[model samples]
Target: MNRTSNPGDNQTGTSQRPFRVTEDELERALRETLAGRVAAPQPLAADPAAVALRRARRSGRRRALSGLALAGVATVLVTAGMAQLGEPGGNHGTPTVVLGDPRGFSPAPLPTATAPAPGPVRAELDLILGSRLETSGGEQQELTNVGPVERAQRLPDAGGWLMTSATPAGRTLWWLPPNGSPPQVLLAGADAVAVAANGRQVAWRDGPDLHAAGLVGGQLIAANQTPAPAGAEPVGFAGDAVLIRQPGRGGFATWSRSAGARPGPTAPNVLAVYGELPDGRVVGLVAAGKPGRPCVALLDPARDLSPVRTGCGPELAVDGLGAISWDQRWLLLNGAGKAALLIDLRTLGTTVTAHPAGPPVVAGVAWTQTGVAMHVDATGGLVRVRPDRVLDGERPTASTIDGVAPADRPVVVADAGA
Candidate 1:
């Protein structure tokens, strides 16, 4: 009898694929081998302090190496004529969310999927503090002399940053350049009811009026006056357009900056609206299929408020306003145990990562290209974690942005190349 050989098997009976190890798998195997040859890592319970410190050191080294590898990969991709995809996920179809109907709506549950094997961590963001913007390269700049700053967002082109500062007069908006020039006062009011910006334009709502202006300096391009309604407020600036919320008639009416505060067509059951993505897609918060569960939905501003994706899960709730990554691919929502829920826009996948102690409450959290930065109010600690590892239940490494008591969540400013 003649026997056939399998493609996976060699003449010596060895497997050709050798278990098909990934880069992460190979690194983990090497670490295990070295550990077995010497000694195993100490359990966190045995010595929590020592374990945290050791992990911090190890994490820093790993991040540095990952950054270098990403740089090389990026160079090769540029040379190979392949466009670098910003966030990994899919946008395949147009999903519809009925304006007022509750029946027949069934949202998928939050995914418990583990993060795929992590690639190199791209270190390209600066953590803004009261004092300055601290780069990952350990360089710091005292860009502003403002007192008790409330919020800071980097402008496009690295032209400058827009911040809300608390002065003896009141809460005011200022444009501070990297060169440490005198801050330009943009707006002075009690506090910004709502604020949003795209590198070229800035928009803020104070009292009943919404204002928009250019970053460099110019006359107000748009001013919208919202009449007194039970619950009406500005959502955010979507590129040049600003979104405003109005209470329900049939469903709810949303406003567009380009439309001069005129209410758009009503959509049912739309709870909250975030802002617009770069591609002109509008993102909002709506009740999921399950009652009391909130989810993020991508809707077309010009069309009906239908969802493209709505699987943000039960953990996603915004305390005040929702936070999103600069790339417009991730939505950060409040979670229990001081944790925060991150939802991927392309994939509609969810992940939870928070402090282990779980008490101080996540004061602020920001997402960059490769990972996230979380600040805990209880510990006054700023930690960084790979989103993939966080989904895998790995602890975050203590970040350099420490000691500052943030008034609000800090924002990550990406360099031009990042």
Candidate 2:
């Protein structure tokens, strides 16, 4: 990090100035940190797949470090990145957000959207810890008896919410009914949980096995548990299957009750797997060039995870905190401490718009029936970004939801269809 002094500093007797960290500098620091932290343990040498496992651990560490660094500088980076994107001949109609110098590689243009643009829908924000709901009618109501929760998501069809809380034993997953009943324990010692887009199916990793069940009457039904790879974390749901990132693996894998678990598709240079489309296509960030410039690509699962479309720009360099809209038409990713990158998936990889929302996206992003909503660090209130407005060449802006106060932690849209 470096600071630039103001010209009138001497007169004011103030030496402090704004700090800036270049993309190259950030990348250098990240590589150095990973080099020291990702060294393979000597005890694993006897394993036949020791080398492969080491590589997997290294990749995971890099992703984790990248996210931490991005969160620290999110406000600064987003401010600078947005200024650049707002410049003439920048992203007004163009499809990318290029920061600093441009790399020579250009991707072929993909097909544009053929269907009518989606209309905006009424959405509400749920202040998780605050235990309040900001309704569509601009009114607030108490969300009774929901205690301190670390992570939570609304169930499909307003079935209620799935939440996780820390306990003396470990972490506990609880199901809170929509009718104001007490929370029920869904799973104990659960690590990472993934809820299906339709909300009928849920999967989670508990210790050495993966467990999944159907959501019926606010209970987990048809519960099934299966063995999973060590250090496997459920990321998202790909239709009926659970998408997982296994340590020491090249890409991602899918686990299902009937099919068990197996590698689906992957690439050599992928750094992080964000989410999957309803049809099982995967979206992830890929590193290229000497310093590892990142690009986002839409991968076809049927074609060995080959990229169907790819887009590279400075804005694509992110810390890996991201979410894909339920409709599979948008991607909201954390920028490297500078801005948040929102990609229009309809373009297949070409269009990327930058929003200065900072990073470590509160309780994750929520997708309304026709738009997107989430809280950003820059704006203490809930921010909404409509896909149709961005497509119409409007710069995305943040407006506070009526009757909702700014929240410091984990505020998400409740019945917004996520």
For residues 1-418, write the lDDT of model 2, one tens digit per residue: 6566667555444536655889999999999888877785346546768878999999788767766665656656666667878787655332332232123546556666576754322345555535664445554545554445566666766777777666666667778777767678877767777776566777888888888888887788887777877788776666666766766534566666664555454455666666777667788876655677677887665565566777776456444566777677778777665556577677654534444433335346666665564644455444566656655655455444344344434456444253
lDDT of 2 at 66: 64
Clashes of 1: 1
Q: How do all models score by TM-score? A: 0.55, 0.58
Candidate 1 per-residue lDDT over residues 1-418, each given as its tens digit: 6567866557644555577779999999999899896776555557778889999999788767766776666567554433323334534322332222234657565555576864322245565665666665666667456666656656665566666677776677767765757677767774343455455555555665555554454233445454433455554655555555664523445455554455565666566665567777777776666564656677666665666655554455444344556577666545544555555666754422222322223444445545454443434445554556655667554443334555433444433222
lDDT of each: 0.55, 0.63
When summed lDDT is taken over every stretch of 10 residues in candidate 1, the lowest stretch is 351-360
Residue 275 local lDDT, model 2: 72
Candidate 2, overall lDDT? 0.63
Position 328, candidate 1: lDDT: 75
Model 2 Cα shift for residue 81 (angstroms): 46
RMSD of 1: 35.2
